[model samples]
Target: MCSVPLPRRALAGLALAAAAPRLTRAAAAATSLRSTEWEMRTPAGIRHRIQLGWPDALPPAGGYPAMLLLDGQTTYPMAQAVAQPPSGQEPPRDLEAALLVGLTYPEDAFDSGLGVDSRTRDYTLPGPSAPPGAGGVEAFLDFIENHLLPELASRFPLNPDRLALFGHSYGGLCALHAFFTRPALFGTTIAASPSIWWQQGVLLKEEQRFVAALPPGTSRRHLLITVGAREQRSEAELAAMEPRRRERAQSSNMVGRAAAMAERLAGLGAGAPQLEFVSFAGEDHGSVISPAMRRALRFALGR
Candidate 1:
């Protein structure tokens, strides 16, 4: 058999047969994500329902990147099933694996369990129009950096050098706050469709402060801002939003605004960290999460 030369097709077939098991294993590891439900307590005694995800079959040792996503009820499950996307949905391939932690409301409801009032209190900045219990972002960040992180460390070996935060809408706004104020806590931040218009565009002020605080020279970190193309409203739509539009000065073109934010941050010269913006065409505010999450996770995994 060694003296005989096999046909090219036969050789190719044999090579493919050898690679099949590896392909299958990779698919299995990607699709069969493992998770555990966790109940946590904030410093103020507020309860938190959380979920953690990792590839199947883990070592007893630690040393993988970790990501914390807000709106756990929504983001948690999607990320778990990332390996099996629906037809026509093209996400990135061979996504690097990491620990995915979801910070959910303490309630039983996965959808809107946190409720408008509870979320408003926990995820927003203070302003004249802010409702009662608003401006608690600092406390929320503290909970994650101090209480939640320590607890997570006890269970798994996490790579502190590449921790990340992922959030959308108001949650996205909250993620930005953490990035600006607690830059050392996480190396990457994925803010999808951040509510920059919230509280009279106050986030821009915070962004400026964040930039000003930089000690000069290229910093180490990554920030990715994402939005849907369809979320942008035309001038006519903006006209209809009048009085209110005039009041907030927040562009109805959400994607454009995000791009502007990216541009502004990128222009901060070598002293600033790397920043990128992505807008998915034909995707609206609600339809952009999957893609945004994909890119965000890739960045966190250092792909």
Candidate 2:
């Protein structure tokens, strides 16, 4: 069961200046719509919060499509940036009508800096190298499936068939995990800059299992995989970068691995999931989030 619901408030009014730096503009322009919050206890007894916003207009069909944003503290603010209308221009039709849900920890606000520590436990598969108390993906998913979705369904007119998920970094790894192991949970997925290097490529093992278990015929699915262009650099380019960037670019072969996975997944006969891979030029792992988030919203919410 969940705790009491809080009063709706304007996102612009929140003292989130320290919370989501990327959303400052959105926060300033977001005074038009009221956002709400709810607290729920996960099956594992961890308390988390869900922040929600509704569009000013509903689609002609009524039921709205929703995207669950992992790293909600960060992503939710960015969602505001994308969803809010700019000066003198009407908000884009599709962007204004979609539901935005942010899944975050109980005590966390957009300004919290503790997400890194919290997500290390919430986002990954257990491995020998995993930190103590880490590896709660299964339990977390269960909370979403059993508790969160039902709650959302009860309050909102959701398009049951068009659910989507977005995750980045470790959270991206989590979204990929759901894509492979629980394909029915989400019809579309956006995994940006996934930490495919985690757990010694544990998701590859899941990929093998997913293909082995796929039922005959094309399972209708859409997945977008994105990485920063700098991830795959010529030695000359790497030499020109700062030492830290050169190290990151050399260490994790993100573009190559993501492309390889797309190739292998596409080979699962004609019934496989439709996949799109994109590389954002002039971006790196950390800097890629804003562009990737915009694209993810467009893919998931745009017509």
Candidate 3:
């Protein structure tokens, strides 16, 4: 049989139109999978959003280790996926599942000032510098300590001793603050690019104070510090600036600070939390989260 060919342009247009729906559908499915959200009420009658990721089925024996991730709206999905067992592969027979719990904020509530407010109000110890009408971290901690923990425990089999806290940037600063001020809050803390420069090196000063006051073997904790190779510039800015501008920028040589912090922690010997430093090559501040999270999960789960 003889056939007549259609014009190339017409054929190309037809092909694209036919594939358009499929491309749209795939995009829609991906969007749906990432849109999951949950809301929990704090003890203070405040509502907070919490995002969760669980394996298809619960582990048979021990309760799973839980990770509390800050900045849920941005980082939760990535962490959740990394924590999941490989596709078509069974979870390790000896390993329990891991749960990722993320804390998110309302869409309109997130702003530069809100970031500062959230961390200052939820992650610090009571102090004079806490912004006016602030210093509510203890109350926020009460919500986590009293309400969130119990609710999670009742809902899922979780190992209280295996809890790990994960945060980045400002959130990372919070995790560090919690580690020192409330040492028992979590078993391990993964501080990825922690803002050690916060409050003009107040955090560093606090760490110094902590080491000085606490007796050896007072508490057990583990800390993991991760930074990107490209973040060195921020450290440079910190070192070059005078004390006044440095404090205003919350700028400090993070690279040096992290190494020094690790060394200081090490001096505390076996009593101090095991401190590990990880640096990713070719990654900048914004791109460091994924690699840092992966390393953190491995460390946290002891995999």
Candidate 4:
């Protein structure tokens, strides 16, 4: 044994075994999700926190498609899961890789009592009966179109033509506003359980205008509107509510209104945005996000 020399094959095997763990770690790091965060103050002096994430994989020809998510604190993680599924799971077959941008507010706004106020201000349209500090959606969209998109494009390989916007609840109302007012900015728009009742169903009127004003040769767009089957309060649930709260709930009518919007757009024939309407069975407002997210990823990024 003292005089024996190891065979070349055995020596090679030892070298390979010693290097395996390092190689595995490197591979994992390369493919893992990476994010960049920063703050931007808009012209009105409101500061927003932006979080951006892109696939570790190389972008395609022009660049990666990007999605701007309102209420980023909640939706970003959901979109991230779709962009890069948890370890050992595969992403959907039709889904494409994309850059995910979370348009959120400062940490203090999120942690303190201002969260509701912030969302209300930035996600609603002005109306005769609007809430306090409401009606800042135009400014929010201005920030995204004039500032955020340009800034992100300069720093990342993003395809401007393939952009998308997503929002839920109040955020969903904002998404609908953007789709109506700035139709060309986002090629795809998804509003999950939009507060169509906002401002006395003002957006329903806006939808009518959007359809009527479609210009000839407008670029193609896609829209997906989803609502929870159980979004409308049940008879017992409504009976238990306060008088005003119950009245508000009755007016919201999330499922019916969402389907009506979809039906109207779908009836526009070839000139309107390609549309899809989905109602998740047994899901209420809060429980609908996850399943809607799956459909949203496909609607935005699917080939």
Highest-lDDT candidate: 4
Q: lDDT values of the candidates?
A: 0.70, 0.74, 0.65, 0.78
Model 4 residue pairs with clashes: none
Predicted candidate 2 versus true structure: per-residue lDDT over 1-303, tens digit per residue: 111122222233334222323333354344454356778887656777888765555333546677899989889989866774434457776653666889988654322243346677778888888767677788888888778876766555566567789999888899998888776678788999888878778888888888888743235788888888876788898899999988876767788888888788777767778777888998987889999999998888777
Model 2, global lDDT: 0.74
Candidate 1 has what TM-score?
0.78
| Per-residue alpha-carbon lDDT of candidate 4 for residues 264-295, written as tens digits (9 for 90 to 100) | 88888778678899999999999999898889
Instruction: Candidate 4: count the clashes.
Output: 0
Least accurate stretch of 10 residues (summed lDDT) in model 2?
Answer: 1-10
Q: Which scores better on TM-score, 1 or 4?
A: 4
- Using all chains and alpha carbons, the TM-scores for the candidates as numbered come to 0.78, 0.79, 0.73, 0.84
Per TM-score, the best of the predicted structures is 4
RMSD, candidate 1, Å: 12.0
Residue-wise C-alpha lDDT for candidate 1, range 177-265, written one tens digit per residue: 87777767777888999988787778888888888777332367888899988778756766777587544434545777688888988
Candidates by lDDT, descending order: 4, 2, 1, 3
Off by over 4 Å in 2: 1-31, 59-62, 84-89, 94-96, 107-116, 215-218, 232-251
Clash count of each predicted structure: 2, 3, 0, 0
Instruction: Evaluate model 4: give its lDDT.
Output: 0.78
